[model samples]
Target: MSHRPKTAALIAYAEALLSPEGQRRVEAHLAGCEACRAELAAIEAYDALVEDVRSVEIPTIDFASMELPLAREAEAVSRQMIAQRQRRSARPWIAAGLVAAAAAAALWWSTRETEPQAPPRAEAPVEREAPAPVIAPEPARLTPVVTLAAGEVRRETADGEIPLELGAVLDEGARVGTGAASELHVRLADGTGFRLAASSALALARAREDEIRLELAQGSVGHAVAPLSNGAAFVVLAAGYSVEVTGTRFVVSALDGTVGVDLSEGAVRIRPPRGEPIELEAPARWRSSGGAEGGAPRPVSVRGLEAPRVAPTPVRLADARMIRWSVDGIEIETSGDVQLGLAPGEHPVRAWDARGRLHTALLPVGGAPVELSAGALQADAPRVRAGHLDEADLRPVLSRGMRQVQRCYELALRQGTGAVTGRARLRIEIGLTGGVQRAQVLGIPESSLTECITSYASRWTFPPPGGPLTVEQPLTLAPTQ
Candidate 1:
């Protein structure tokens, strides 16, 4: 049984002609050997086919010019000969070939009697089937939905921005933005959630299982990422760099041309537009210098951020019925004046007074807590005057100052940090007296560079509009390499 059984042995085994000892041995071999078993089954199938062929009745042949009695006699003789030949062969193999030949002859004779003769000059036509068409595969549909939403969260649609609610299924490539006092939490099918903070926005980009990527336009997003499988990734694109992770919890922000990351668990890799990738671990804070000239994100010391503060700071709220605040993505609600041991970073705080008016502010927490009065909180926000300038009056003034803007960028480059280049958005207000009222700049990380640009922009004068007119202009700086 080390090798395959011979052909004759196979035939003998199928016919039950082998001795009991031989039968036992072949059966044992077949039980273990698939190839040998297949061969044996095939032999059995052939024998069955031969028996079916022998059982077919041979029909009487009829000639157009011959008598019916003579045709009947010829058919009877053919059947007798076939049956006699079948009885003569005891071996199944020999019997198979003879039965097949006899069956073919019978079929040919029967077909001749039933078919009408074709014209001598005509030939049969051949038919062929067309080749199968090729079909392309469709892409995978990833359905990440809004699991939790608070305040004013909106998703961008064809019509415009619509309010985003819980359980709303988000489509791939959709852009979602949060209001000044809003929050949004999106969960993937795999149970990972990316919570967008107040005044933050991000595009879904790609949400496939293998890779999930988001483009952060502005504001902050806290990510509570689930453990990912091998070869899968989760990435956040902000400013000119990307923060990629496998499975971790962290917060990333892209505010005023700066990128920052605060990791509390797991690890992440930050890839900047320039320089090598930096590996950041848990219980650490990293931030890029938010200035016109973009700087690399480096490990920075935040007292309450990396770890808990040693002491709790007393926060006094006068005449407030309810108050609420959020740390990471978790929300906390309390009543009356309360002491909060908040970390020394920017945290959003909200309170409701006796009149039910909501007052919210981004509290810059220090080692000690500060008193927040209802009137003082209201007064902290600036008031904006109505704009009276139109595009026709503001376009030329900005065009003429392009060289001055370039000079400001050159001055920033000559400082300690080298090659400062990026796009900055400048917002200018023209007063009724035609002098620049107020100027603000965004997108450039360097404060000195922005100050220089804004300072020159404010000196530009325009024709009196009889009212305050505000105009926003975009500036780009590309230093000569």
Candidate 2:
């Protein structure tokens, strides 16, 4: 069966049979094939369907009009013939002749009424397409009805959720609610599987080919969103709120009317419980909640934002002049030799010396104090990859440190070896996840040794911090031994 026979084809056959050529083919085939005979009979059952679609503007059909009366009529005629025969033998012959003529007339009248009629005018178009028309089929109708429990809407595309039998096909970047169910086998668009916790629900509103669907289904299941080679977006639904983010991060208490988003370092959008959606810079935080229908989000400040800092390069011995700091336009400044103690925050620092010379620098604020003095003021603590930085521009901070040991260790080992050393400038790139992007040894000596020192940072990772971009911890490095 290379091709299945279409009902349309059968309909066409019955139509063609009305033609001389169709009549010949049917007569030839029906003479021998019982299957063909059966099919013909079946097709005849709904003969009205083959006619013009327009004329079928059906009024209720009187089914009683179609009843068979052949048996009853035959029995009545037989009784009449028996009475005629008993009345007279001589007249019996005449009666028999009359009966034969009458029977012939009756048969002719019945067959005449059943003869096919000329098709109606309105049906010409349907007759034309009766040959064939293409129409794509819909999904096989699954039982035609779906029912879900309270807080239990299920959907293939995480957002358009509806309470279902927990068989929704969740795609990558989808979400479900908390407390929706404890067991669910959701297939993400990225082909990943997840089991929702009971009393939790979420949505995978975002889809990614290279990442885990950012599903926020109830009760934070923990996020392991697939990493985008370059970068991508993710979103999940919780309560009346929805979260959009790029790269991997974490969220806690996203059910019960409150949702927390700690973008452990990535771009994200937090739609609040009652207003507009806000774009979140990397290394930022957000919270959300539910309201009325798909409630709008209200912007709320991210908690634990490190205060902004001001640190300008001083000529080492030169008296530091005017120093000022501002993030959202809140400014802080100090003059000559005295440095302003700015709060910890990621901010651009500007300064001027007594010579009226002005300078600017980007300051990544952790919980530590940054001196406003000139050249690189080494931190008192062992900073992430902060071994021997020579470059004035490059900075890389480690948050999740255990992931890159070899890279961090080599920089430490090469510190004093002077084994072809310089300021040992190095770059440690980190995602919001604090994972290393590219580690390079810059402004330093070049060698397999130099490469070795630069390469030593191949093992650093950052733990969840206050922001998205990795806390760039500028460091110095050189080849050892």
**Who wins the lDDT comparison?**
1
Q: For candidate 2, what is the TM-score?
A: 0.22
Clashes of each: 9, 74
What is the TM-score of each predicted model, taking all chains together? Answer: 0.36, 0.22
Q: After superposing candidate 2 on the true structure, give the runs of residues whose Cα lies further than 4 Å from its correct spot.
A: 1-198, 203-218, 228-232, 273-285, 289-481
Can you write out model 2's per-residue Cα lDDT over 358-431, one digit (the tens) per residue?
46666665444444446532213322432232233222333333224345446545574344434444566554
Q: Cα deviation in Å at residue 199, candidate 2?
A: 2.0
RMSD of each: 33.9, 33.3
**Per-residue lDDT tens digits of candidate 1, residues 1-481?**
4667567887888889999999998888789888778888889999999999999888777543354455466646654543333322222333335345665355334333321221111221110121222323323445566654555678999999998755566766899998765667676645466878878999999876678899999998888777877668899999988999987888899989989888877899999999999898886678877333334332221112211113324444443444453433445333333333444566666655444455666667665666555554542243344657677776688778777888877887888453666677888888877889899887767578788888899899987777778777887768877
Off by over 4 Å in 1: 1-139, 290-329, 332-481
